[model samples]
Target: MAALLEYLPLILFFAVYKFVDIYWATGVLIVTSSIQLGYHHFAHGKIATRHWIFFAIALVLGGLTILFQDEQFIKWKATVIYAVLAVSLIISRYIFKKNLVEKALIGVLKSANEKGDTDAPLNIELPKHICEQLNLMWVAILAFIAGLNIYIAYNFSLDFWVNFKVFGLMGITFVAILITMAKIYKYLPEDQS
Candidate 1:
């Protein structure tokens, strides 16, 4: 549900492109992204940082595409967003001495604890090496995605690029998540009694 909502703009863009054209599709992307953001804020009481970033990117790049009557801006949007995220994650890990993945995992554990899940594997702190490795993994993944987007956009037809953006990227991301979970599974705390 949330995953589908996150991809609503891209899905709408692809569908609109089929019915109309790139410019009109870009317009629909911007509108749908805005609506998705609004819905998140309304439901969650506060928008997540990533949601805000994506919404801003969609609006700005989509608007540029529509304004200039060029699809290039929209085509580069994914690469730009991924690059920004990769850089931000790297900086957060190195400069700020924070691992975003670890923080998020800890938050989930805390939430579970609060919900009275007594058996939850609540680590007081994620191991530093694990945090660093996970952060680097994410950086590598995002960089790969950014490069992949550029490669596809430049080498493939617009139709192929649109399909890749909607389906290929999502499939890649899902696989990456599964791999990450498998790698970290051993690190999770085991019940002791």
Candidate 2:
């Protein structure tokens, strides 16, 4: 159920794209994301601010694309969102001593802190300096993904873009998460008990 919710936007967007227009697809995604956000807030006592912001941007860009009747606007939507996220991550590291990724990483670190031994610490606690360095890497990867989207969209067709939006992104993100988890595993303490 929770897993489905995470993928709902992409699924809704893809379905609408297949049956309707791109703008309609985007609109449906916005609506579904709003509902999902509201549900999370009321039921889980949490709000997905990042997703909400991205959805808002998608809505505006989708509307603009439809209004101008130019597919380029819609294509550029991914680029704009990715660039904004990357820049924000980089800035947060420098100005706030922590970025979005570090905050999220902390959640995992805290759990590891409570459970794992200190035989070989990954220092998942992550100092400010390390967070800054990580933010740089994160921003670069994000930009790379955005650039890949642009390259594919320009050279290929809409179908390819939509498929990449789901399968390609999901696959790549899964791999990245796995890599992170593996690294944590390596640094895990020897005490299994």
Candidate 3:
């Protein structure tokens, strides 16, 4: 159910585009994106920066698409969002010297004992080098996705581009997640795995 909700906006946008048109699809995308963010805030208590960024880009670009009656604006949203994310990750790593991937995975710190010094429960401690590598991998994937989106949006037909946005991009993200999991599998404690 959570997974479905996570993707509800994209799924709805695709379905609406099939039934109506790009304009309607863009409107639905904005509304559904907002709903998704609200759902996240309600369920998780706070919205993540990436989620906020995604919604802001969707709203601005989608609004322009609707107001100007140009699907091109909406089409560019995906590319811009992906590019911004990739750049953000690169800056976070290179400029800030913070590995966002590592920061994301190291959820709430908990001392497993009375000493308040042990972190045994979260045994999945990935090495710093591994985290840096994973961060680089994510940045590379985002950059590739961003470039591909622009290429398809320009070269392909409208319907094909919409389909690519809804399915192709989502499929890429799923595959990336799977690959990342496989990459990190060796880092997990044997007893937990």
Candidate 4:
């Protein structure tokens, strides 16, 4: 349910774009994203940081697209979001000394353990350097995605870009998440417990 809600905006945007046009799609994106944000706030009592970032940018870029009667503004939204995420990851890892990937892995491990799951690995900590390497991998992945978006949006047709944005990028993102999880298994010591 939550996952569906999270993707509702993108799914609807793609459908609307297919039926009508970019301008209408941009409007739909903004409206649906705003609704998603509101749903998060209403249900959770607060919106997540990523939700805020996405909504704010989508609203601004979508607005620009409508106002200027140009699809280029909306085309850049995904790239901008990815760039912001990459920069934020770099800043958090360096300035704040926080590795979000490590934290996410730890949290998942913790939850699995707490659930009394036999498959859950022991709370063995990953080495700091290995964690840093993992974080850098994510940063690189995001930067690559951002660059890819720009390249495709400019070179390809808007319809192609829309399909890539909605389905292709989503597939890539899911694979990235799975890859991150796979890293924990690869780098961490086998839980002999």
Candidate 5:
């Protein structure tokens, strides 16, 4: 798909680096992600919030890796980013009483409602309590997945790490989205039909 192609450079770098040096691959990743971030910011009017955070963390970790020549820094980057996001999600749910994931998802529903689509708004609605519960569910899921990533990266090789970074993350996220969709679908208002 076109979306996949847009990330080809990153994918290819990961593929070609199996026998190549890690620094080269790391450099390419940093450069490519930075460029991609710039492209999004200039064309899309705003950098995606989560991705921007990911890139910033990657940038910092990449710099540390280069400076110290320690692969551990690069390896732990995944752990740190995942932990930060997981903690943020958990804190938002428990402390702030917010569901950031749901808010992002609801933007689509809100947009449909704003567009005066009678049927669209009905497709997604929930009691406030269910919304909060679902949000907490997502936070738990994210934390679990983050911990899983740490396990894989620490025990596995670089090739596996790269593959997991691409395919594994995508696969897990797709599964999560499906689960979320199933939960939301049941709660759709009868009027939406």
Candidate 6:
């Protein structure tokens, strides 16, 4: 359900593209992304930084595509966004001495503990090596996605690119997420007997 909500804008964009045209789809995407961001902000009292970044990119790129009457801007939106994220993750991990993946996981565990959802007190500290590796993995994933989007945009038809953006990218991301979770499972604290 949460995942579906996360993809709502892209799904709507694909539907609008099929029903009408790229311009209309771009317009719908902008509106839907704004709404999604607003909903998250209102419901959670804060929005994820990544969601905010994506929303800004959607508005700017979608606006450019609509205003200039060129789909290329919108096509390059994913690549630019993903590249920015990849760079940011790398900088955070290396320059800032922060591991976003580990921080995010620890944040979730902290929230769960605050909500009394855990059977035992959760340890927020992760092994330094694990954090470094997780951050690198995320950076690699984002870079790969950025390259994949650009490759598809340049090589495929607009319709095919749209389908790949909405479905293929999501599928690949889901699998990557599963793999990441599996890789990190061994690092999780053991259940208290």
lDDT of each: 0.84, 0.75, 0.84, 0.87, 0.72, 0.86
Separately for all candidates shown, the number of backbone clashes (residues 3 or more apart, or on different chains) is 0, 0, 0, 0, 0, 0
Position 98, candidate 2: lDDT = 61
User: Tens digits of per-residue lDDT for model 1 on 103-184?
Assistant: 8767865775666647655566557887778788889999999999999999999999998998988888889788777766
Per-residue CA lDDT of model 6 for 1-193, tens digit only, reads 6668788998899999999999999999999998998889888898988898898999999999999999999999989988998899888877898777888877776665767745677764567887777788888988999999999999999999999998888888888778777766776666411
The weakest ten consecutive residues by lDDT in model 4 span 184-193
Q: How accurate is candidate 3 locally (lDDT)?
A: 0.84
| Model 1 lDDT at residue 26 | 92
Worst 10 residues of 6 by lDDT: 184-193
Mark the regions of model 6 whose C-alpha exceeds 4 Å error after superposition: 110-117, 191-193
Give the Cα error of residue 180 in candidate 3, in Å.
1.3
lDDT of 3 by residue, 16-58 (tens): 9999998999899999989988988998899988888889999
Residues 1-193 of candidate 5 have per-residue lDDT tens digits of 4376356545855765675766777777778778777777777788887768777876887778778877666776666766787788778877897877777667855665566646443356566776776677766777777788778878998778878877887788789888777777766555432
Q: lDDT of candidate 2? A: 0.75
Provide the lowest-lDDT 10-residue window in model 1: 184-193
Q: Quote the RMSD, in angstroms, for model 3.
A: 4.3
Give the TM-score comparing model 4 with the true structure, all chains together.
0.88
Q: Best candidate, lDDT-wise? A: 4
**Clashing residue pairs in candidate 4 (N, C-alpha, C atoms within 3 angstroms):** none
